[model samples]
Target: MFIIIPQTPQNYALRIKQHAERTANLDIRSGVNYRGLAGFLNRPFAEDHRDATVDVTNPAEPPLVCVKSLVEGGRQTARSYHAVSDCATFEQDPPSLVNKAAHLVWLQGYPAPEWINAIGAQYRVDPEFFRRHLIFLQSKDNHDFAAMPSSAQRMLTLRLTTICHTQFALRQTAIEAARNEATNAVRQHQQRLRTGDSVVRKYSVFDNTIFTIDQELAIYVERKKQHNGWIAIVCSDLGKDLTQGPGGLSSPWLGEEPASPPACEPVIMHVPKLALKHPHQHRFVNVTSNGSPLMYQNASLLADTIDLQSGGDDIYLDVREALHDVFTLIAAAESQFLTMVQGLVDREIQLQSSGKQTEWTLSNLRYFKSSIDDHIVNLENTLDFLRHPDVPKWAPHTRSPRALSREGTPAGQAQHSRYRSPQGEAFAEYSRLSSLGDDYTRLLQRATKLSNRCVENTTILMNMAMLEESKKAIVQADGLTRLTLLAFFFLPLSLTTSFFGMNFRELGTGSMHMWVFFVVAVPFLLFSTLLCFWGAVLPNFRGRMQWAWKMFTSGAR
Candidate 1:
């Protein structure tokens, strides 16, 4: 029985406070948490009910609703519940709160920050009880009860099942988004590599190849074009709710990190998990499925795929169709990259007259190598998603349709099996996706190999060019040294002949004394010798002298 309460938090808190006070006075907690009409624990849906007035200003807190039912083995009374007059309905004895009876208190939202304070203001409860129940709550949601056997004892199992499905849906969504982004990133890199070749063209030996489009503008372009990610909608089951999961999410619950993790941090020393954060952030880009984010994601962005595949469509089909679209985009982007690489490689082959690698070509090759690596990552992600363990775990296994004909079998069991009943048809798609992933991997591998080979060729060509240039430099320096030596050899004779050719008739030979010859010849001879010693001789002698000095010093030491 649904007992709707006012949305205001205070209304719920009031009843909880009253229950605590009464339970304390009586010195015994109730078997069922909520009271019965004038007699025992009330079964509300089986009796009186009312609709709640909702107020949503406070995001941190939502109205709490209590679900009270008979405990296992508790005797059923003929009296019906009065939702408002539970105390009046019970004449002599009131219901016990936490004894032999089964008690389920579904906190509609997360444990409100004020819950403890509100409950504690009047009465105190065990801190451990709150801590344990909250985690049990973490694993619960509305879907579990949406399809279930109504035994509250099986709440934990139902909750865990919800989380498992949640985890997979999240994983599938995140993988698709990430891989698609990776493939597109590679495609974008290729475009820059090809169009940015104009940078290489801007250079000749004169232009110095020092600056290119890639070096100056590519970084800015990438930063500008990069899509900084954001979340648009929360994907969760918000239509209805239950007690089995972390509180039944009446409101959409995506990724809300508590101000703190489970309050008992010192006791349980493990890292807090952020797995939910991923899929919650990675909204489906262009399609819809069980894993798709809320329709609000495409509210102003685009039309949602959920509209086309809404009522009664198979979830697996929706998922595959979404994935197929993504893979197509991935394939197309990769093909463009391959085309660019092929063109570059063909050009490289045709230009047989290879020598030194220009700075432009070398830099471009380095960037292209990064694209090859990106493609490899994209391919691996594709495989990882296709073969995810959850896919098989969630599939209906090899049971024949006849095996599922039992009338009482739940719909979830029938739909979830991979090979069982009608679900084999759905699981068959997993094999196809895996095969597709393999095909794409081969394509990526081929591209990477081609890129690797081209890079190796460029490296070899650059090394050879450097070696040849070094040899030319050495030979030119040697020729310069030889010419200097020959000039010195004829230097004194040339000076003497020039002196004879001079018109020195005005100055008599008498004025030119024997001392003059000594001065002129000796100075010229000394200058010539000094020039030859410092320029040619010292060049060859320095290395030998250094070696000999080092040897002598070592021997002395």
Candidate 2:
């Protein structure tokens, strides 16, 4: 299974003879088994069976899983049986996307470097270049990989198991192809959403958001807009944390391996990550759009139920990270609403009046309130996705002193040799995210208060409008009253004058005396009516008439 080559040309005859004998015994004509080899390597996320019950609880051992291995032998194609009986896929690459295609397939399961080199030769770059140089540039600033555990190796097999079991080789350009499709769709949609006259980097607000990240710098952001031409920009920031070694430059062994580059950081190597439970070593993989999350988990390697049930500080780091990422997103949404609120408040204050529906209205507040309720529920659901699982089967556990002692273990003593995960530095970062979630909840409350204040302002403005209408109504009523009184006072005198002028033989004769009475009486009545209204109604009528004149002249429309 191994060879030790000496760096010498000193024994050519003897070495040639030995090589010939070994080659004769072995079938040199046999081809390499790439498919079975790939399938065997598929189990990246394996359970070490560190838990004893997995094997014992099995009713019976499963039959050997076999796949045909097809390899190239010189000019001919050849085949072989690659049995997955107690396959050591997990044993091969463990955590890194090593066996699978990641930066460089430098791990155990990949075909020999010479084979990969042969393929690379067609593309004018050696497979050795990655093993030699490029990989060193990746994963520099992340302590995240360093702080994880062997159980985390489950991450690797997530995608591999799917790719192999579903029986498809990892596409050489899967990311590239999917990326072009997704980017084009998103870019087109963005173009549709943007107005041709839109400006950038200004104090404007929006109802939706698009986010982007500078991959190389690791500068992730939820941007307000999808800046034009940004799709063409490839963010090629490999992490700086790589090549600095797992312990970093501060390690005492700086004097070691001086020839080659510094040791690589412990990469959180995986093509996907989701979660579930399994026996032996079941693996899974997920692929997502750029800046989206993927899941990889091996469920069979978890702690006991007692520890997992303990809430609060005892959750897994992956769970914590998920929670943090979600809350951060929710907070971004709230921030958008808050920004709109700020602009509206400024406009209202300037106008000294509640703006109309098309400008700024109560509906904005109402929509904001409804959104808050919906999102809080969603936030709870997000947490539930992490919690609602057979988590005890894969996640690490940490029990408090009392819980540990319930099994009668002493304070400083160990408990059942179970996997007790520590609250490592990684967990601390996740905790910050959790705290940020709380902050967003508080921000939501503040927004609710502001919403209330806006409602109150609208109410006050409405009342003032009612008062102005009431004052106009009073003035119009006074004018109508004066006109009614004048008509009523003249009624009897006008009737008498009409009777005298009838000129009927039985009714009466026309008379100059009647005319004299009518003229005198009408004048007296008019004078009395005028005196009655003169002081009391004049001011109101003049003011109302002036208002009507102003309305007619100014063309209020």
Candidate 3:
């Protein structure tokens, strides 16, 4: 007979297969059983007992049994035959009968409640005592327990029932906790998300800030690049590193080759001369290869070609120098961006640590605003000059009234005189007043906006801080309340000690012996009363006392 059990969701078939493969040297495959139960038993469950008896007194053991049957034409023939058991016939013998009884009970669906009750009755214990010791056995490929032994199978069924009940209870608690955590997480994320607009505005402000910084950096990079280009050009012109000879100067220890004199190398000298005189020297020389003084003609042609090539090489070097400067400027711009980003990040961190938000500082923003205003002003001034009728058409021309007067006294001198002075003065005054008014207006607008933003942010932070402080106060108050309750709990003891300390001889005939006895007896009585008070009275009084305190404080406050 065999017992069947279903698989649990938590079970991992591949892991079980791996474990079996490692421990038993078996190639256990996953999925529905491909191999027979016998192979699985031999590989993974090899430790399972075939013929074992268990003592029924030990809750860890379940009843077991053996079967004997005679088959005719593949049909079982039931006959009364002696079968092995787990209960002993005698006290000293192993409990073979108990194992047999348990196995029989297991074959009939384990009879969970009945088995638990029977075990409890026999051991004079609770049903849970027997159920807890039970272990579940499962199939290798699937978690099905159909092939397990009868006695072991019954224990497994009861174990599963108990575990499922426990897991169900735990799952409910976990689900509740998870729901609460998710609620809190959503609330927190929502709070952060609400700040998204502010964050975007901050980014825009930061962009403008960095734009101003980059303008300065661009100027610096351009200057540095130009300086670097000049240095490179100067170095190239000085013939530095232009030789094909040994790097710089060769070491004396290395044997030096004898230098060939220019005179001995007559062909070298003559070729340079011929090349200098003839523009198409190489073509001419090729045509007159058999002509007289061929070596001298070749030398002259070679020299001219060398000089031209040298000049072209110088130009190439200058171009390369300029390219290096541009690359340097590009590299500097990249470095400046990195530096600026790092600085901004550091400033943000500092502000956060100091309990301030990044938006509170308008320094960078103000700088950018000022730069834009200045740029606008400069553009307007240039436009004004371009529109001016009397402005000089070109450089080096005078446009002053005195120059105009020196050229010729116009017939409309009185008209020029009539409008010039007053118009010029009015224009000057108007320009100054207009600029002042514009500057003042812009300053006022920026200041007002900044002030309003500050006030709004301050209000938000203050409210948040107050809320946090209130929460902390509530927690502290709770702790203080507990301490106060504890202190009040010992009030009776304190009162008793204080009462005993006072000399009270008003009761009966006062004597020295009575006084001494009162001193000892009163304390002993109070101590016993306190113990009884703590054990019984405190539990009863706790709710009432807490209520009274709440009422009294509510009224008093």
Q: Could you say which candidate leads in lDDT?
A: 1
Q: What tens digits encode model 1's per-residue C-alpha lDDT throughout 1-557?
A: 99876433244344544563465456566312222211211112224644221332221111232222233343322222212232233323323333223222222222232433233221233222332233222222323222222221111110000110111123333433433454343233223321001111011010111111110100000000111110011111111111112321221122122221111001111113734444332222322233322212111111111211221122221233222433443454455445555665555544534633344455445545655565565555454444442232122233223333532367535444542223334343333354555666676677778778767867866786788899999999899989887788668758864675443434563444445554676777778877887767786788899999999999999
Ranking by TM-score: 1, 2, 3
Residue 434: error of model 1 in Å? 3.2
Best by TM-score: 1
Please list the residue runs of candidate 1 whose C-alpha ends up more than 4 Å from where it truly belongs after superposition.
Answer: 1-322, 352-359, 387-431, 486-557
Candidate 1 local lDDT, residue 301:
12
Report the Cα lDDT for residue 392, model 1.
28
How much lDDT does each candidate structure score? 0.34, 0.31, 0.28
Candidate 3's TM-score: 0.18
- Cα deviation in Å at residue 28, candidate 3? 99
Q: TM-scores for all candidates?
A: 0.33, 0.31, 0.18
lDDT of 3: 0.28
How many pairs of residues collide in model 2?
22
By lDDT rank, best first, the candidates go: 1, 2, 3
Summarize candidate 3's per-residue lDDT along 406-442 as a digit string, tens digits: 3355643443443333335211111222333344344
